[model samples]
Target chain A: MKILVLMKMVPDIVEELEVASDGRSLDQEYLRFIVNERDEYALEQALLLKDGLGATVTVVAPDAPEVDDVLYTARAKGADRLIKVTGLPAGSGARATAAALAVTLPAIEGALPADLVLSGCQAIDDLDGFVAPLLAGALGVPYLGLVSRVSVDAAAGKAQVMKEFAGGVMGRFEVSLPALLGIQGCEKPPRYVPVAKVRAAIGAGGIEAVEASAGTAVAPVEVAALAKPEAAGHAEMLEGSAQDVAEKVADILAARGLL
Target chain B: MAGNVWIVAESWKGSISDATYEALALGRELADGLGVRLEAVLLGHGARAAAASLGRADGVLYVDHPALADGVGEETSRALAALAAARGPGLILVPTTNVSWDLLGLLPARLEAPLVNFCREAVVSGGGVEFTSLLYGGKMAATVGAGAGPVVVAVLPGVRPAEAGKGGAAPAVEEVVADFVVGGGVRWLEYEEPEAGDVDITQQDFLVAVGRGISNEANVEVAEELAAALGGAVCGSRPVIDQGWLPLVRQVGKSGATVKPRFYVAAGISGAPEHTEGMKDAELIVAVNMDPSAPIFSVAHYGIVEDATDVLEALAEAVRKRKG
Candidate 1:
């Protein structure tokens, strides 16, 4: 089975975000970009599948030429080949990107195409968690999101995945390829990519950039502005003794029916 | 400011959660900012009836099918995708609930929209909507924005109260009929509710909330005593919810239930965005912590820079004195 992992280069989410003077975007003066953290897990899972079943793995991402570093890392991590779509319009949102990729995927996958596609549940940056279903929809295949555990039978063309839901409940799902999966917390903790291997991948680079053909365009109603929220308000600490405070807090919780 | 606002009202068993209404309120705010009409798309059985109360949207697109009664992914996605294809909304808002989480990354890919999850606050400023999410386990806040297409965002439950219209005329509602195709290789086998007695915290009237500061499991009893004394409930942070110390429903944050209490006493919590966002709307907040720097203090109406366990015990004694 041919496995493809979709990855994107996103700004690190841990840093503080400052609005630009135009009030329309991030300041970008000191933004650090990196491969999405959860996507690394997706790559790791794809690699593990490849190692176990002797399958070919390919990594694709919609990004600029500068994202070659990501492609090289995928190759070093055991991807058979890497494809990056560069110079597609910048400032395109997820729908446009997915639409663009949907048009490109038929050709990218060809006749003997990927049997499975894996991606992180959500990029820490976009945190929208939309790519997996969009790709599967475009490709006319099945899609699963928020998968915590997965086991595949390449020969049987079936896979069992565990989904983590709120309140510690698990939803088990079975799917057949070609399918797209949006993976979140994993069965095992995400493995670390060795620094040496990353350096090596960075050095041995031969990444091909492919641009996507436009298709099925939809006109958005209006532009939405992005800005930070107003600073939080002053906390009104309820005064009293422990039991008194608890009662006060309890009264509040009870009033709200959330206690 | 580019993109029409989209609201996804989730349904299960032919009913919508209150968080869905709350998200509609947020959608109304976004629509106001964009100067576009709020559009709500309802999917599943009885979705139209459940969504009828969301009066803020300018248009209502309802898709009804029996397949959705069992949480049909294809049905839900197809319905949403079809609506999105017909009337493109720039920002899609969904309540961060179990059903929404199930859609997870899938919806964005289906609609080809960028998504933000666990968002607490969003405002239109520059040219796009910027969102603030919890960081460092809710210790801080991180704001993010997408430079391109339809943005899909999931706001944590209980982060914001559903905005109520104050004697204003209702907006016009437009319904669309579209055929959605559902044929993914997967099917829902069953929908299982968690085992009974798995959690009874939902019944607690007043909760003594704990966060990362309570490193020991035994220390939880300290909170229990305070809850007992106050005749309240014992609740926990998301970590505790994940750890089985508390039920998932009792977990406070975007992923957990949006709780509003007459009073909320947070002990040893740093008030991360996910947790704090849920409780900021509480009627009263009393934060207790050893570190004064904890963000919980910012939202607390009153606070004490002391060990929460010690303070809890002292407060319990004081309550006994005053009440007796």
Candidate 2:
């Protein structure tokens, strides 16, 4: 089985984010990029499929700063192939990214077309969480997203999938092969690759660069302004040690007759 | 140029959701700005009666079909695309919701229109709609404009109050026959609700909510002890739920359960909009996080910059001693 995972690099939220002077994008100077958390889960789900079916897993990512390290880490984690789509415009949203992949994935040299495509249900960057569906629409295939569990009925050319929805409600589905899925998570946490193994993978192989022509977002929406969420009624900060704060909390609850 | 503003009214199990109403509120504002009619496109099997609540819109384009009963991505996308193609609404505003999540990714493509997702706000400006979308999970915001063409936008909740979208004179309803054949490539089989938990967190008067900052499963017990002493319940944000540290039903978030408790103690949560949406309505909020910069502090009535587990335990002891 051939499985492909679409990956995106998002600004790590742990670091503070600043709006650029352009007021349209995040200030790049201080921005730290990492593989989107859910996409990492998507990759983990693919790795699980690889372990079960001995499937060849190919990980693909759009070009972004610090993405090569992430791709290298994926290779270290057991991905068989890495293809970075280059020459795309910066800050392309989910639609443009999906559109580019739909065109570029088929054209990667010497790699078989993926029978199953997986991506994070959504990335923190756009939070559109529509990459899987957009790619499926572009490819004219069926898609399911917010998926948590999967088992392949390779003999029947179908897969049984579990999708968790609002309130943790789940629906089991039988999706035909050659479909796309937006993976919310896997049964287990994503494996951590040590720095040494990632370095070894970097020494062992180089990523294939696939050029993508599609760059512009079809939505002509331009970021007109970017600003920190204006602080609404700011929290009245309680002073002192943990014990002091706790006493204050207890007192307030008592005053409110909540305790 | 197209002349009408439209929102895709999302429903599940025969009831309209607050997300649909929320989108209607935004739709009303956008429609008023453009001087056009606001319409709600309701799709479901036997759902015309549900259209009555969407009185904020000028009209309801009700499409009744068995295929649309479940809001399947393929069927609903095609149906909405066909409707938009026929009527050419200036803009199609969709609430970013579970029911419409699948279609939002496919609808824009089917309609051959641009899409803005994770939208917090939108307005008709300079003869076009400008959208404010939350990116980086509310860490950053982006402004986008849909230029002089039909656009599909997936709006986030809290952009407009749900109450603002509800209650007006009944609107006219127009029945539309969907034009496309329902395709089945991804088919549904069965739905499994969450296993019943020991308690319903939604009904609690006070909720001690832990977030990712609580760190691990071992820490969950600490928060539970605190909840017990405080005479409340232990709930968690999505991270804790996703980590299996807490039961799904005890989750407090947009996708889990919204709790309007009398007092809400948020520990270790960074306050993603999804998490905040559920607990923000709490009458009193106390946020405890090591990072004072956490967004939870913004909504919190009182903020404590401290380790959540430590503070929780300390608070639990304090509450017990005070009661004694």
Candidate 3:
């Protein structure tokens, strides 16, 4: 089996975000980028499939310094190949990125004959989670979102997947091979690769670059402004030690007949 | 076509969802500002009746078909794409639900139209609409707009209050029969419900909700002990449930159970919009978090800047001493 994982690099949310002076986008000078958390889960799901079915895993991501780290880490963790798409602008919308991938993925040498394509269900910055479905549409394949588990019947040429619905409902479905799935998570947490193996892989140095053509996929959405949320303006902050605050809470609960 | 706004009414189990009404309320405002007719599109088994009850729209375009009962992605996307191609509304508003993700994604790709999701507010400006949405897990807000063409938006639920439609008479209902086939390669199977938990947090009048601030599964007991002292139920945010510290049924968020308790105590939750959407309606809210800038403090009536574990133990001890 051949599986293609669409990966993304996003700004780490741990550091504070500031709106640029233009008031339409994030300030990039202080931004630090890392692999999106869900994409990590997608990589893990692909690796699990590889372990079970001896599938070959190929990863494709937009070009960034952090992308190199992710590619090296994935290689150390058993990914067979990595293709980095370059020349795309930073903070491109999901649709534009997916359009570029549609043009680039099939053209990558030895990347065709893919049996399945996997991506994270959503990214933290996109207006909506549109990449996987858009990519599926571009590829003219069936698409499913919020998938948690997947199993394949290679001989039968079909796969059974567990699709999650709202309110904790899970549905099982059988889809044809070569379909796209937007992975929410896997049964197991993403496997961890030690620093030494990643370092060695980085030193080995087999990163391939693919130049993405400028497509007609333009970002329909524009940023009018960015701002902080308004304060609630009604909270009465308690000041004191934990004990003092606890006692105060107890009194209030008692007065309200809650204790 | 260039001056009209359209709302795709969402329904479940043969009844319109609250999200549909919320979209209609916002649709009314957008329609008024643009001086255009606001039309609603309904697709289901009993869509005509549901469309009549909307009352706020100037007209309704409905497709009543048995195959549309479940709102499957492939069928619905094809049908909606055909409709949009024929009657090009300036803006299409859809509620941000599980199904909307599929429809919004496919319809835009099919038509190559601009789309946005998780929108909390929208306004007519610059010959288009400007949408305000939360980003970076609700850490910051961004306002986005599309150029003068067909744009699709999925409005977040619970962001706007539902208003009664102009309620005088039923609007014109036009039946549309599109040549879209259902059931491509995927089939709908039975839904597997989550395992039942020991306590149903929805029925409780008081709740102590723990978030990632509790740190680990072991610290969940601290929140439970505090809940026991207060004679309330224990629940948590998505991270706790995702970590297997609590059952899925005990989670409180947009994707989980929506609860309206008389009193709510939130510990360690940073108040992402997804988590707060389910519990922000509580009669009284108290928050305890080490971060003073946490968004939960904004919605909380009482705020405590301390470690949740420390606060939990102290509160439990205080309750015990008072009872003794």
DockQ of each: 0.20, 0.66, 0.62
The lDDT, on a scale of 0 to 1, for candidate 1 is 0.67
Q: Per-prediction TM-score, please? A: 0.66, 0.95, 0.93
Give a tens-digit lDDT track for model 1, residues B119-207.
77788876567777653334335567665656778787655565541113443445566566666687665544557664455445566
What value does the lDDT take at residue A136 in candidate 3?
88
How would you class the docking of model 1?
incorrect
In model 2, the runs with Cα more than 4 Å from the true position are: A110-112, A127-129, A215-219
Best by lDDT: 2
lDDT tens digits, residue span A160-227, model 3: 98876656667777788888888877877688899999999999989899999765675657777877
> Residue B168 lDDT in model 3?
39
C-alpha local distance difference test of each model: 0.67, 0.83, 0.81
| Order of the predicted models by TM-score, top scorer first | 2, 3, 1
Please provide, for model 2 over B1-324, each residue's C-alpha lDDT reduced to its tens digit, 9 standing for 90 to 100: 356998998888778888888889999998998888999999888889999999999999999898887777778888888888888888888887766778887887787687777788887778677787777767666777767658788888777889999999888999987798686587878888888757888889878899999888999899889888877889998677767787777878755787898989999999888788788889999999988778888889999999899999999899889888
Better of 1 and 3 by TM-score: 3
Q: Where does model 1 exceed 4 Å of error?
A: A44-57, A61-92, A103-112, A127-129, A193-227, A236-259, B1-8, B25-42, B46-62, B80-98, B101-177, B192-251, B254-324
